[model samples]
Target: MSRTPPGTRADYAAFTPITTRWADNDAYGHINNVQYYSFFDTAVNAWLVRQGLLDITASAEIGLVVETGCRYHRPIAYPDPIEVGMRLASLGNSSIRYELAVFAPGNDTAAAEGHFVHVYVDRATGRPSRLPDALRAAAESLRAPGSGSA
Candidate 1:
């Protein structure tokens, strides 16, 4: 497997604090690999909600995640109060790519980093829809410098 270098807080535009629970640990004593994806989702949605781009119950348009990936640089165990950093890697008419980093308390470098892709769709039809102006603008605000043109 190829190794992925950890990213720093400076690489992201926003952050969400997350606390690891006892259940986050596994038999081996570190966080379960599956939980990392949840952190990514939480961080992304938190930003969207903060920007007023997502209304879970009433929005006609919603983002449906179509792809995701992660690379762990170190183990994160229970009781670690971490922060998940988020930034946009790419934006499109109907899609967006998000880059995320999980940082241990007081650490500048990420313990894990990942990417997630979401395709905007009409909630009723489940068909691809052009991103709303507000959503697009909000995403642009979080675009990483030199990452891509929004």
Candidate 2:
């Protein structure tokens, strides 16, 4: 299988800083592979919260992660300050694809990179719903040039 190249800081539209917790490390002595996904989730949702696009307790709509994948280029461990870079890869009526990269302090290239797709659904009905205008606008602001849409 072919591997996707790691992205540079310039490729992302937004960034979130992450602190590596000691418990995030695995028996192998580096952050567990699964923890990378948590970083991705935190980065996206935090951005949404900051934009007032999400109110986790009472929002009428919520984004449910539908798909996720990651590629690791290097190991990062506890105490290493990292940053997660984010960009919108695609936007759809009911879903969005977020591409994210993890950068070690001072590095321009990613130590890990991946994507996750979130399908927006009505919180009470659990059915797909069109994205709210504010939410859509917030997402659009994160789109890098030449990104996708549907």
Candidate 3:
């Protein structure tokens, strides 16, 4: 497979600034590998919440992450402010693929990048559900221009 080059903030549809906590650093002093996934989830969910598309506690439909992966290009440590850039790669009947990148403060290139796929499902029944209209529209708005088949 071809390697994906690190992305810049401009490549994304939206950006969220994240403050790294002291607890995020590992024994080696860099952020733990798993924390990148936390950043991914935070960025996407924050956008969805801001758009009035997600009601974590009461929404009839909720997104359940089905797949996730990340590529690390450099180390990010506590005390370093980070930015998470996010964009939609595609949207399906009940799923959406979100692409994300983590940028060190003031850096143009991503320190890490990744993607996660979430399938919308009934909160109670755990079965696939059609993407809610508002959510779908909001997701569409996050599609990067000329980037993917969203």
Candidate 4:
């Protein structure tokens, strides 16, 4: 509902570079709205993997995205390099909310911004579980000091 982008540099403590693909553009001649979500997902999970917090294949505790929303301010097309800025808003007993911003090359403002809530669950039971200490620690490191927000 905000004209201004939601996630910004102050909100993200880490960054991941992304390259737009030729196929990512839609008939509208810009990156499709849905593709932004994919980029959002990829950036967050890639961070989790890089930090050794998420085990996509074998961990008993796995995160399932329960909610996501995005706001697009401008179009991002192929052939341009981008950076996805990311941070952890909070770590609940069983869930974590990640703030994300997609920035085009050389742009200080974001093209799209979003947040995703991932609920950790037991793989076999599909029941919510307390976030692992390691996972929580990893997520906390990505949060900007004194900047956790809703």
Highest lDDT, which number?
2
RMSD (CA, angstroms), candidate 2: 1.6
Clash pairs for candidate 4:
none
Model 2 is weakest, by summed lDDT over 10 consecutive residues, at 141-150
lDDT-best of 1 and 3: 3
- Model 4, 77-96: lDDT tens digits are 98888899987877789999
- Give residue 138's error in model 1 in angstroms: 0.9
Model 2: per-residue Cα lDDT over 1-150, one tens digit each: 987778899888899999999999999999999999999999999999999989999999999999999999999899898999999888888998999999999899999999989999999999999988898888877876565552
TM-score for candidate 2, please give it: 0.94
lDDT of 3 at 136: 78
Mind giving the per-residue lDDT tens digits that candidate 1 earns over 14-100? 899988899999999999999999999998988888888889999999999999999999998999988999888888889999989
What TM-score quantifies how close candidate 3 is to the native fold?
A: 0.94
Stretches of candidate 1 exceeding 4 Å from the true structure: 1-4, 145-150
Writing each residue's lDDT as its tens digit, candidate 3 over 1-150 gives: 988789877888888889999999999999999999999999989988889888889999999999999999999999998989999888899999999999998799999999989999999999999989888788877777667656
Q: Residue 127 error for model 1, in Å?
A: 0.8
- Taken over the whole model, the C-alpha lDDT of each candidate is 0.90, 0.92, 0.90, 0.85
Following a full C-alpha superposition, what root-mean-square deviation does model 4 have from the true structure? 1.9
| Candidate 4 global lDDT | 0.85
**TM-score of structure candidate 4:** 0.91
